[model samples]
Target: MAKEATLQVRMDADLKEKAEALYRDMGTSFAEAVRIFAKQSVQENGMPFAMTANRKNTYGRLSGYANTKLAAEEDGAYEREMVGKHEKTD
Candidate 1:
């Protein structure tokens, strides 16, 4: 085998710990699992699973709850005017 290279990724600390524990239960280290995924992706020429979700419009969907407040914004200002439900602020 050729010399191995390091791959660094940063994520939420809690999520990383959860993933590590799950991989341990499955009898594989996180790095080993990532290697298997990389090899499979290379052999398949792309992701080996279907991604049917509309991920490109993600910000639109994610911000829907704040749409009314954001509607009044111009040039991209979105400061909240209400402190909570049924509560208005000065």
Candidate 2:
């Protein structure tokens, strides 16, 4: 038999409730979902999904505009143009 471990995670109350509800609707609990994610990650030898930084409330009026690219092939020219485009902060 495999030993079990516990992992305590802190997150927004509302977010946690919503996620747990969604998991329940899918016939699982949030903890189970996390465990599945962990197992998949191990099988894949890395993260099973792509992770991106949240852009909201970043630093500019448009929030993360300076870090965005117009296209994957633009070579970062889009980021330069996005900066200072919206001067009003917040």
Judging by lDDT against the true structure, name the best candidate. Answer: 2
Measured by TM-score, how close is model 2 to the native structure? 0.54
Model 1: per-residue lDDT, tens digit, 1-90? 774698897767997888789999999988788888889989999865544345456444545434455466542433333334336432
Worst window of 10 by summed lDDT in candidate 1: 77-86
Q: Put down candidate 2 lDDT per residue, 1-90, tens digits, no spaces.
A: 364788998767998999999999999999989999999999999877554454443333334334345445577666755765555443
- Give the clashing residue pairs of candidate 2, or none: none
Per-candidate TM-scores read 0.55, 0.54
| Best model per TM-score | 1
